[model samples]
Target chain A: MSQELKQTPLHALHAELGAKFVPFAGYDMPVQYPAGILKEHIQTRAGAGLFDVSHMGQVRLTAPGADAALERLVPGDIAALSPGEMRYTMFTNDRGGVLDDLMVTRRAGDIFMVVNAGCKTEDLVLLRAALGDAHVEYDEDRALLALQGPGAAAALARHAPGIAGLGFMKAATVAIGGTEAWVSRSGYTGEDGFEISLPGDAAEAVARLLLGEPEVAAVGLGARDSLRLEAGLCLYGNDLTPDITPIEAGLTWTISKRRREAGGFRGDAIIKAQIADGPSRRRVGIKPAGRAPARAHTAVVGPDGAVVGEITSGGFGPSVDGPVAMGYVTRGCAKAGTEIELDIRGKRHAAAVVKLPFTPHRYAK
Target chain B: MSDVRFTKDHEWVRLEGDTATIGISEYAQEQLGDVVFIELPTVGADVEAGGDAAVVESVKAASEVYSPVSGRIIEVNDDLEATPGLVNESAEDEGWFWRMELSDPDELEELMTAKDYKAFLEGLD
Candidate 1:
């Protein structure tokens, strides 16, 4: 029997907007609205796009030493995180592979974390087993929304004043639609945006309020995936997996200087060694030769016609007006401008290694 | 107007004498959203009835367009290579995927007529 799919708090609203639903992370989530993925993607780059990301897991950990306790799990310098600061890090396993990537925010009295929907159950189990005294509170009562693009701030500022002042990677409690919500100036789309975590009961009201803005259109997972792909952001299961390490994924930067020197997190030794003598393979941005997209699982071919790597995330980038993809390749072939061949369905297509963020990041600094 | 027949896979065949013009239905294109790329079977390629003959790719996913009747491809849509979105704009007319010489005209009898196809679509909802 097929498993019953879950619905987000904004499901009714999405249906009202004529969103096409698809199964993702066990949820019947909207993949695109009537405007379609291409238009939604371009709209997010040009104007404001509102997204219902409530399927993502949200939790709050409270303890006297929550920051230090959290540091023992991930390589990020959570202990140094001041209140209202958010850091992106991954849960590394003993073998140095990434279990999942998550966002850790230092709230006033606790650490607020948002994990991938597919990994939430496993993450909670791991966190509960590892965090001895820290109280892990699953905030299922809340919903997450992302307002992104060039015009996002202007549209959001009308609802919550002073939100535009919060710098990138910063978080603050703001009143949105007359309800308290945690607003963070960070997003996966590489656009100027804010992620608002609010009460589930108030989600629909605030969503409608945001959609009421002329600049804000409802964007779905289809555009969300394309937007993040263009931004070069890694999706949890695709670009990252149990077999991929932060070092191999080119996410070592998330391992801060202090965290690198202290070396106490899980798989620290393996990660340290990989950092010292670069990883065998690294994730790099790929641009195919022509209009035909090289999708995920497409083999990366070397000069000798040997399979060297495989595309993890890929599709037609509406904004780029061409095919953009990301994949893991031997370190030697990971450099920008390196010529590679993508074998799509028994045919080889010419491609090149390029710097990430296929489109320039337009974060609000 | 020539008699148009549709297959369960959403491909449409417009029969005229010994040749038939094939393309996906407008409903199929609307369901697939914006078409980005399409790969058509080469001319002179023999395709079996109800077999894959073309691929239509949208920004979201790729779908195979099946041949409605056994035939040898006489003409393939080359314009789709540069302007695949034409399929979304005119799926039944200018967006025809190919023209084929019917190997067995009796195969057309197995397909659904326009009225039956319309009822089939309604039943799907």
Candidate 2:
């Protein structure tokens, strides 16, 4: 914690925007701007919200069989990915718990991956040791930006013409103002959006260009967390960790049929076993019947007053206009509509198990 | 007929005779951002100075609204149960958290006046 914090390419812009900074994952990042988290969350759903994702690690795997090597580390069917196709997958430990969840895109001969800011260092170490240091490279010069919302494509289309034609989970290399970027028609906000990885130096200009667009606004980590929470997306350290397996965390869909059947990846046996026989605990969406939000670490009890689990993440869903959360509960209580109680401030409150996401996804598939 | 004072924790107390109305300061509400819910202390509850008397849940975090001085709760703000954003809209007046009878009026002397509170906020940044 004593070490100096890092800054992104858009740090000065965030300061100019009147952002309140906070230290996140070893970086001095903006938590929220003057408009605040609520407005930003709503804006991301209604219009395009730009996020500086440069803190996330942009890694490259340059090898003939990079997909195959990546497949060994993740349970996803990486080798089956067609060129320019992206898949959401997780790096699992030998015990089957997630090391880090990442996005893997199959490039021409090599592969590209984006990892969480906090987990990147360890993820790099793991990848280098497995895929050889010569093949694994994390480019510090690269900066990433996420333009997310229903109007994201419209805003970006003005800058990059072909972006409108991009389908969900598809990737394209497009030029914006002479800067080449690896653009993907995917985002974690459960909305139709794009994740653009471009040169760090050009990042500010591109961000400025997008922000100049009528629909785009600069968002921060605070709204990003709330938006993803309402979207039912998992945050790395909170909802996912080394102690939680892909199956337990409700990410079994990430494991391809081939990998599930062949069982060759790290912790394949355990993961596959859990796949066949359901995990003891399963992550589920929570809806509080009242206004009070049950924040993270609050204990969840079942109908009979038995402790079922604990809330991984919880907060006021600005769009939903109430409290929504996600957590791992006993398999018996994971079903939708199951009654539960959350111990908030020493009092139990009635809540219900609901299907994620709290809102419907509007992907441009 | 009322004296206004501010606490270091950012709560505000408006003392009129023996009864005082309490709420967070504008500076505090802006910091918390978009109040979604608030848990008010019950009427007739006796609370000590600096003790937690209300819970304010913002979109980003949950913070305790402490009593600026020792008092016995006489009334609670029920409006916050439905319109918590009032804290953000009118933090000092309409968004007042509760009303209580001061058990020890001398404690108000330890709080900051309007000028002092403004200076405190200045020193913060």
Candidate 3:
């Protein structure tokens, strides 16, 4: 039986725009508007796209040593995070597998964290159990919106001035339509953008304000997925699972040098070990030689026709105008330009291991 | 006018003597959204009634298009390989997927007629 689906604050607004609804992460989220995914994907690349990310888990951690407390969970250097700075990291299990990847920001007098929607419940439970002394509060009454693209800053600056001045990975409390909103110069699309966290009641008004801009079009989960895939960003459940480690996922950059040596986070021992001697199987980009897209779970075959890996995330990248995929392959076959085959429905199609970000990242540095 | 038949899987068949032209219905294309790629069976292949005949990939997901009747594939739509969006633009007419020589004419009776298919679609909502 299907469970009851939750709706975000912008659900009605999305409906008004004729969005196609699909069940995602327990929420009845808009997968695409009437413009369709292909056009929406292109629009985002050329201009700005507004996304409703309110279903994601937003929480605030308040305590004197909150930064240090968070360091015990993830491998990122949270202690060195200056105020109004954000870092992308993940919570790992003791077995060196990633529990959930999240974005942590050092806010004024507290630390703000946004986790994946599906893992939010367990993540909150885990955080509460581990950090008993710190006051962990889930921000259920807030809505998060991401405006991403090359033109994102220009469109956002119309309503929230000085947002253009905020450097990448920086966050600040700014005024949007006279309401206080926490704006961050960060996004998952590999585009220069801002994620706005504001009161739920003000969500529709803010969304309309952004959409009213000429450059900003309302984007849904479909275009968002393609854009991120083209940018080589990982989706939580698809790419980063509890069975996958940060090192294997090519997320070694998230583990700072100091964190690598003075390891204190969960799964640090195994992570450090993998860092020393490279991981057996590494995540790499796969570019199918044809138009046929090799979707997730498609077997990656070696030259000898033996199954070497499986596609974690694969789809047609509108920007790249071809089929692009990412999957785990044996280290020997993980090198760029290595030839492989994708077993798509019993038929093997020639594929090559290419560098990630099929479309080069256009983030504002 | 050609006698058109429909299957529960959303595939449509237009019968002309012993030959039949097949394609997904307009409703199917609408539900599938923007079709980016289509993989149809090669010509001269044998297909069974209710068997998987082709694969239609939209930006969101991939769906299997089932053969409505048992037949020998005579010709497959090569145009879909170059411009799959045609399936979205003219799913029933210009975007037909394949042509087959009927091996079992009796199987056509088991499918829904155009009128019956219209009612079936209404009941789906």
By DockQ, who's the top model here? 3
Candidate that beats the other on TM-score, 1 or 3, i.e. the better one? 3
Superposition error at A6 for model 1 (Å): 1.7
Off by over 4 Å in 2: none
With a 3 Å backbone cut-off (N, CA, C), the pairs that clash in candidate 3 are none
lDDT of 1 at A257: 86
- What are the per-residue Cα lDDT tens digits for candidate 3 across A1-365? 17999999999999999999989889999999999999999999899999999999999998778788788899999998999999999999997898999999998788999999999999999888877735889998899999999899999898989686899999999998788999999998989999999999999999999999999999999999999999899999989998999999999999888999999988889999999999999999999999999999999998877889999999899988888899999988999999999999989899999999799988878
User: TM-scores across all candidates?
Assistant: 0.98, 0.98, 0.99
Each prediction's total of clashing residue pairs, residues at least 3 apart in sequence or on different chains, is 0, 0, 0
RMSD of each: 1.3, 1.1, 1.0
> Which 10-residue span in candidate 3 chain A carries the lowest summed lDDT?
A126-135
Instruction: Sort the predicted structures by TM-score, highest score first.
Output: 3, 2, 1
Q: Write the per-residue lDDT of candidate 3 for residues B1-125, one digit (tens) a residue.
A: 78999999999999997899999999999999999999999898999998999999998789999999998999998999999999999999989999999998999999999999999999996
Tens digits of per-residue lDDT for model 2, A1-365: 89999999889999999999989999999999999899999999999899988999999999778887788899988988899999999999899988899999998877999999999999999999989999999988899999999999999988898675789999999987677899999998889999999999999999999999999999999999889999999999999998899999999998878889997788999998899999999999999998899999999999989999999999988889899999999999999999999999998899999999998999997
How high is the CA lDDT of each candidate model? 0.91, 0.92, 0.93
Q: In angstroms, what RMSD does candidate 2 have relative to the true structure?
A: 1.1
- For candidate 1, write residues A174-213 as lDDT tens digits: 9986999999999989899999999998999999999999
lDDT for residue A194 in candidate 3, whole number 0-100: 91
Query: So what's the TM-score on candidate 2?
Result: 0.98
Clash list (residue pairs), candidate 1: none
